[model samples]
Target: MNPSEMSFYQPDHDAFRVSVREFVQREISPFYLEWEEQHLVDRTAFAAAGAAGVLGTRVEEAYGGGGTDDYRFRFIVAEELASAGAASYSAGLAVQEDIVIPYVMELGSEEQKRRWLPGLTSGNQLGAIAMTEPGAGSDLQGTRTTAVRDGDEWLISGQKTFITNGIQSDTIVVLARTNPDAGSRGFSLFVVEAGDSGFSRGRKLDKIGLVAQDTAELFFEKVRVGRDRLLGEEGNGLRYLMERLPLERLSIAVAALCSAEAAYGWARDYVFERQAFSQDVGDFQTVRFTLAEIETELEVTRAYVEAATLKLNRGSLTAVDAAKAKWWASELQQRVINRSLQLFGGYGYMLEYPIARAYRDARIQTIYGGTTEIMKEIIGRDIAARAKRR
Candidate 1:
């Protein structure tokens, strides 16, 4: 079912979806090929998205954002982007809206908000969260990046890899170790600006899919920032990360479900239209059964994701719940896209086909945010703890 048909969405949400759909058609669909070739989307597209009122729907009106705090609007954006086969663009925007904005809004001091929120909400600037290192992917505790206090300033030095929007972001929320002896409490978050001395962007890493999204290595060689640049309290970065991860995982789940739905729609329509042995390809019982399975899986998954989105809006979504949604929906997306591509036979293997690109794009859903294995670990640990308490 389309997001409009979902009972969780109000009429206002439907209206926002219309604007988002139009934005995708006009700004993204036309230039996506050029972006894919260049390995990055033009910065103007983000500005257009900001103008269209789709970039920062949850930020406060005082900050030049939509100011609703409603998660459904963000889901609507994801749905429309998936429908338009704009996965790369969606991933980049998710980092801004889902990860960076929420971190700032929840943890930043008033001055930090005033300084960063306006440009971010207006799409005049981009933001990224630097968490993963060369050695750390899911393990936040393994982070080697360090920040040392220097009188009124802090000197941050580290390397961050696989950072979305790394190249174009005007601001980055960097996670660093502040007290080596403090364990989990040792980590802290620092706001790094683009022109800061000792800060440099490495190569835009090549990936198999989502090519238009710029992922790069970020280096900090004693990048200095005043106490004012520190986000929240010192030694609270890991706690902050854990607190905010539910929204990030939920955003990934939303994109995965929407992409699966779009792929299913494409396959269903193609199977009915394409001719085979004296009949439509969909007339075959095997194809009919495959479509049935795909539809059923999508419908069931949508219900869970819808519930999770509501929980997020109500401020009750848990890490365990988000983990379940993330792993299930992302794995489902890969399966649905793979099966849907099979429906197209030879045509599915070509890049000209959206399903082919989607197939490539879907592969990363299971790996990023948190991997399928990591999600299971989170859920499994919760289950074990609950059993012990019982």
Candidate 2:
């Protein structure tokens, strides 16, 4: 689809999008199945992306990035990656752009930025954020990992699970409970490097989908961290996560929408080519009408996501708005996938088809980024507050 038909992206944005799409087609798409079999993409892919200036487009120019501060560039990255049926690539990059870079840019001291931003921007150092523990998934109050005060250093002991880019990460921004007695104010963020004496990595996890992406368990056993490692302020991890999570959710929404778009396009092409009953499936009224309805809904959904993207660029996006986008786009993506698969009949169920793998991977979009139920709770509270104001 021409991006011009979509109102969210401008002409310049479309130009950038086309370049990124070409990059994915030429460098990544053909080799993805092999990478999936190995359970990891070749590290060379990251370097190639960095060299192309696609990996960290927003980081300042002095630090080896393109220095375009626009978030739209990041959105283009998400959209193109999704179009290629490479959600793992989209997600792994989100860790670098959406999840990790923000902490260093907004909260890190000058010395910290000077030391890490250049390498991070150049894809020399991969990063991950450690938040969800074995005991706590969404409830920050239940976090049990603790960082204790010891003169100028803090000793941290905790375990974090389901961390993206965890296996190969060179730096991790860890969220630990610094004050056990305080409820929301008790947590703090710390930056821990790979070689921290007591820090160790757990097994790279086997997951249901996104197999090429590294998802692993992490353990910090009496890890000693210097004062400079603290990210924002002491007892402020909750606040930092709150500030960053909307972007993370938005990234998930972008990926889900793009994946659905790709699936729709693939299935549409397949129906026209496959003949049955001496006619193309596309010739059948039922198949034609099914695609029509799906296409309309997808276009409408794209408009909503684009509007949200604009709000995000303007720094006007709210948590409730992001919740609405994340939940609705993901739910719509699943619906589109299901309907498209039905049109494909038996071929859709085959492992060889890309749609089958997309269906499997799309399942986690709702579950991981705060489930649909959680999103409703957030939206419900917003509704209640507005009612009271009235």
Candidate 3:
């Protein structure tokens, strides 16, 4: 499949691409490496992104957002960040745009939207979703976090681990079981404010890759919130998650595709510049063929993801389709980056190299956003159901 053959983006999207590239270069590129060392993005980075008008797409204009519902802008921003070797920053922003923002936009009430959208679009408030627990990874049904109604307020008590944007986030959308016996249907989503007395954060977690992004453990010890905080109707949380999960998986697929492109770009630039035996390393058959294979594989995968992105924007993408995009693209990213690193030999092992950081970060794409195994399960179940109907 060829990218040119697909009618994925228009001229307007291309123009927005340049704006995002400049914004990332001016604001993010300079500070990202330092953030990697400190284990957190600079607090100011979020505000800077807000001011740039690139952070909020699909958010209404009245609330300081871009107003247009185009997701191509989000895709463009991710591609630019990956090109600039800012995969960690890309991951952080994706959580806000792809994971957290949609919950408020789709499931939130008009009052909820009025209260939160401005800060969120302005980047004054960071957001994160707490779904993963210590015991459960892809299995949301096993969630033990409980939220009980106490008159006007709901008391929430549960711990969430591996939460992205944990430390710096101003608003957190938490998942807790409102009814113990209702199984998956019992869970509910709540917006917990940062200053809530009972909410406390564990230490910023240390991870092998994406060091600049904050991953933390969060505990809610009887946190209380009004009924207004609940995202949709009572007992519809799991249904909402099931409906919205395709977007999350598609977001991961977009990142994986961009990561592979960046890794290939690095390898392409390096081989021509480096010399072995007084000749360009890129001139050798082994090096040339490896790079060629990576390019071809990535181009083919790019077409599938491009189509998926269009489907998502049209509201026609299915969970099974998203799972296919997520798993294949992530696995392809890992393979491409690994090969790119191997080509660099010793230099690739160093953390300073862009490829090294990319290599480290690519490991988690398959595991998170519903593990590759879980993605296969989703698709397999769909296949079984279709066959049964026949």
lDDT of each residue in 205-254, candidate 1, tens digit only: 99999999999999999999999899999999999999999999999999
Tens digits of lDDT, candidate 3, 1-390:
222234677778777877888898899998889888888898688778889888888888877888887777888888889888887788888898887888998889999998888888878899999999999778888998999999989999999999999999999999999999887789999999999989999988999889899899999999999999999988988899889899999999999998899888888889999999999989999999998899999988988998888898898999999999999999999999999998888999998899999999899999999889999999999999999999
Score each candidate by Cα lDDT: 0.94, 0.86, 0.89
RMSD of each: 0.7, 1.3, 1.7
Choose the strongest candidate by TM-score: 1
Q: Model 2 over residues 1-390: C-alpha lDDT tens digits?
A: 656566666788888887888889888898888888898877677767787778878788877888876778887887777767787777788888788987887889988888778878878788899988888998877888899999999999989999988998898999999998888999999999999988888999998888888889999999999999998889888998988778888888888888898899989999999999999989999999998999998888888888888888889888998999999999998999989888789989985788888887888899886898998999999999999999
TM-score versus the correct structure, for each prediction: 0.99, 0.97, 0.97
**Full-model lDDT, candidate 2:** 0.86
Q: With candidate 2 superimposed using the best TM-score fit, by how many Å does residue 105's alpha carbon deviate from the native? A: 1.3
Query: Residue 328 of candidate 2: its Cα lDDT?
Result: 96
Model 3 weakest 10-residue run by lDDT: 1-10
